[model samples]
Target: MKTKLNVGCGTDIKPDYINLDVADLPGVDVAHDLTKFPWPFADNSFDTIELINVLEHLPDTIATLEELHRIARPDAKVMVRVPYWNSPDMLADPTHLRSFSERTLNFFDPAFPECKDRPYYSTARFNIMRKSCYIRFFYYLKINARFLTTPLFFLARYLGAVVWVIEFDLRAAKSDNK
Candidate 1:
C-alpha cells in the first residue's frame, strides 16, 4: 500500500491518504497549521507527499521545503503546485505570501547553478522528474496541454501573463545522515 500524505489538503480530502489541514474540517485527519515548525509526523515518514496549491501560502519557502525534505523518505515523490508569478492568480490570493516561476524550485537542486554556487542556502535535495505549467484563458478556459511547456509555449508564457499554475514532480535525494 502507498503511504501518501496530503499536506494542506483543505477541502480536497482523500479517503486512503492521510489528510491534513489547518482547520478541523469534516474529514481532515490532522488539524495542524502547516506554518508551524516540526510537523507531527516522524522524520522520513511518508512514501509520497502532495503539496498541491499549498506552498504559496506559507511564509518561509526554503524552510518549509526543507521540512518537507526532512519528512520525505529516500526517493519519495514530492508534488508541488503553485500559481505562476506573472499570473493574476498569484495576486488574487492575499494569503499567498510568495509567487513561483518555473525556475523557482531549481534553487534546491544541487546540480542547478542557483544551488551549486550557494550550497549554504539549504541541505534539501530533490531531482526534478517533470515540470509543467497551465495557462488560463480569460479565467475560464484552462490550457493544461503538454505543449504549453514546449519551448515555444514556454517562451510565450514568459513574455505575457499566460501560465497560471506551475507544477513540479520531484524525487527526494536523501542519505543515511539526513
Candidate 2:
C-alpha cells in the first residue's frame, strides 16, 4: 500500500493523507510534537511527504529534515511550502523560527556533499529542482506609495513578498566513497 504523510496539517486534512500535527484537531491522526525524533510512523514508510508551513516552526532544522529523511522511502518525493523571508506573513507569525530564500530547499539534495555534514551546512549541500515565487499586490502597493513617489513595478518583482514551493527527491548517499 502507498502512504502519504502530511506534517503540520493544522485543520486541513486530505482524504488520501495521514494528517499529523502537534495539536489535537479534527481529522488529525497523530498529535505529537514534531521536535521529538522517530515520529510515530515506521521507518521508510512514506512514499510522499508534505511539509506546509511547518519547517520554519522547528528550531532544529537539520534534525527535522533528517527525521523526514528517515521515514521516507528511498527516492521518495517531498514537497515543501513556505513564505519568503521578505513576506509580511512570514514575520507576522510568532511561531516562525526560520526564514527561507530561493535556495532554501537545495540543501536537501543528496547529490551535494554537504548533506553528510552538520545541519548548519545544509544550505550549501542541496540543489534546487524547481521554485516559484508568489508576490502580493497589496504589499507592493504599500511599498510603492511609501518608499517611492513613482510606481516601481520592477522593484516589486524583486522585493515583493513571496510564497514558494520546492520539491526534492531523497536518495541514499553513494557508498563508493565510504
Tell me, by lDDT, which candidate is best. 1
lDDT tens digits, residues 93-164, model 1?
Answer: 889999887778888887689888877888899988888888777788987745558663466455766677
lDDT per residue as tens, model 2, 12-111: 8977999999999999988999999879988778878888878889998778877776777665667776766766877789988997765555566654
Go through the candidates in order and give the C-alpha RMSD of each one to the true structure.
1.8, 7.0
Clashes of each: 0, 2
C-alpha-based local distance difference test score of model 2: 0.64
Off by over 4 Å in 2: 110-128, 139-178
Per-model TM values vs. the true structure? 0.92, 0.73
Candidate 1 is scored at a TM of: 0.92
